[model samples]
Target: MDDTEPVRAEDGCRLWTDDTGHGKPLILCHGGPGLWDMFGAVATVLSARMRVIRWDQRGCGRSERREAEDRELAVLQWSADFADPATARGYAEQLADPWFGINYECNAAITAEERQVWRETELVTACRGLAVPTLIVDGAQDIRPRWAVDSLQEALPSATRVVLPHAGHVPWLEAPDEFRTAVVNFLCPA
Candidate 1:
């Protein structure tokens, strides 16, 4: 796992991937389904001690597009990638044309045959073990359901939650001044 390799998926999509460094495996899945392996900076920092594996998902970057059959199954996740409708237009305008594809970032979760494995992974238990100060800045108008955020707030006992009244998911883009002030205040309290 020291060099980049060209791999082919069972569905026949050609993938470009690589594995480097040593120690715990850290797979940095990019955000958008359309986004490619543009995490060089992140890999550079983590590769010092981590075994980082990166790949361009199907139909993105250098990977070949999915076959017709697989494309049918991919339609839903591809469409639901950005559930926030309010920011969809603005976000699309910000992106270039080559960045639209199926991001299989959560393939394990989405394509798993059994739910018990994921269910048994107690994320809350892991979060409870944290010993450092934590801040969760959320938007009051975020597309993500409130219950989801509430669950995280409940799980993280030491995390302070800041909900900007008029902001959405990308609060910095929506309200830069307020977002900056909140972050600065939290990071460098007076």
Candidate 2:
């Protein structure tokens, strides 16, 4: 069974959430301050054995869109060689969809806030307190540096990191079978 609902935040923002299946709960958060829950396939597979909850971040996806101060930043363009051409093209097409509208203001604000938090907080120390098992999956060819993810995995006591060699930023899109297998093995060890 799949159920979707709007959850109100303390600040009164309505976040869109979908909950499915029936065992231990696993929340799937999409990447990007601008992206929504695009984990339908992952949810479907995992939901058979566990409750899967997917939610759009504030000001993103199906959540309530809010207007904020304009903060413009130059967009970074990747070279053609950055990722596999076909995979890159597929991602571009996905982004062109109306449902994939980019929320620049939300991205900028959240990015700025994240920078501040990173600078102000002892992230490693904070992560050390989190005892829950964590799966840190990364694409070996992602444009973003992997050191940060490596550090996170090192800090968390129960964290397991999986690096998919044949993928880029969005591993599931490029290597669906491998991605599904890795996630399933981690979430439902046999």
- The estimated TM-scores of all candidates read 0.47, 0.54
The candidate 1 region of ten consecutive residues with least summed lDDT is 74-83
Off by over 4 Å in 1: 1-88, 95-101, 105-121
For model 2, residues 71-168, the per-residue Cα lDDT tens digits are 11111232221358755765644444434445769999999998888752487788889999999877888878788788888899999988899787
Please provide, for model 1 over 19-135, each residue's C-alpha lDDT reduced to its tens digit, 9 standing for 90 to 100: 788999998776665679998788778888989998887767777765442454344333333335665455444432344545556766666744654452477787777867788
Clashes of each: 1, 0
Clashing pairs in 2: none
Tell me which residue pairs clash in candidate 1.
33-103
lDDT (Cα atoms) of all candidates against the true structure: 0.70, 0.76
Candidate 2: regions farther than 4 A off: 1-82
